[model samples]
Target: MRNKPPSLTESQYFLLAALLDGPLHGYGIIKATEQATDGRLRLAVGTLYGALDRLERARLVEADHEEIVDGRARRYYRLTNDGAAALQIEARRLQQAANVVIGRTRTAEA
Candidate 1:
C-alpha cells in the first residue's frame, strides 16, 4: 500500500468532514462544523481561512469554484482523493484506539 498522510488535528478533521458532501464555501464550512459539533467547533473567519490555507497546501482540499455574492467573493472547496483517504485512515485508527480503551476486541463485530 502507499504511504498514508499524517493524522489530522481535530480542527483539520472537522474541516475535512465538512466537505464530505460535495463542495462548500468558507462560511458554509464554518457553519456546518459548528452544527455538526453541536456548536462546540465554532470557527472565526480568520481561523477558518487559516486552516483552509494549510489544507490547500497539504493537498487535502482545493478550491472547486468561486462566486461573486453581493459584491463579495466566495470560494468553495472540495476534498481531494488523498484527503478522503486520510480521513478514513484516521477514523479507523481512532476507532481502534477507542475499542482498546473500552476493552472491546475485534470479535465484537458481528
Candidate 2:
C-alpha cells in the first residue's frame, strides 16, 4: 500500500496554492491568497513569514531568489515538486470530503 501524504493546514494549503502559478514574494503571496479566497483570509506579516519559514524547513517551498526593491530585500519563493504533489493530494482529499456532503444533501432533498 502507498503511504498517504501528510495533511496540510488551511494556511499552509493556501500558501502553497499561491505558489502554483510561479514564484512570488511575501507580499505577492499574501495578495494572491487573499484574492483567491475572496478576501476571506488576510495574512498578517508575522503569520505569513512564520508559515513561509515552516514550509521552507519542510522542503515544500524554497527561496527562489532575492532582489532589492526600493532599498529593501524581497525574497521570492517557489513550490518544489514535493510541494506540488502534496497540494494535489490535499486537493483531492478536500474534494472527496465535499462530495460526501453534497451527495448527502442531494439525497435528503430528493
Best candidate (score: lDDT): 2
Candidate 2 residue lDDT tens string, 2-110: 3455678898899999999999999999999999999998999999999999888778899999999999999999999888888998999999999999999999999
Lowest-scoring 10 consecutive residues by lDDT in candidate 2? 1-10
What C-alpha lDDT do the candidate models reach, one value each? 0.90, 0.92
Off by over 4 Å in 2: 1-4
- Per-residue lDDT for 6-80 in model 1, tens only? 779888898999999989999899999999999998999998999999989889999999999999999999999
**Model 2 TM-score, 2 decimals:** 0.95
lDDT of 2: 0.92
Index of the highest-TM-score prediction:
2
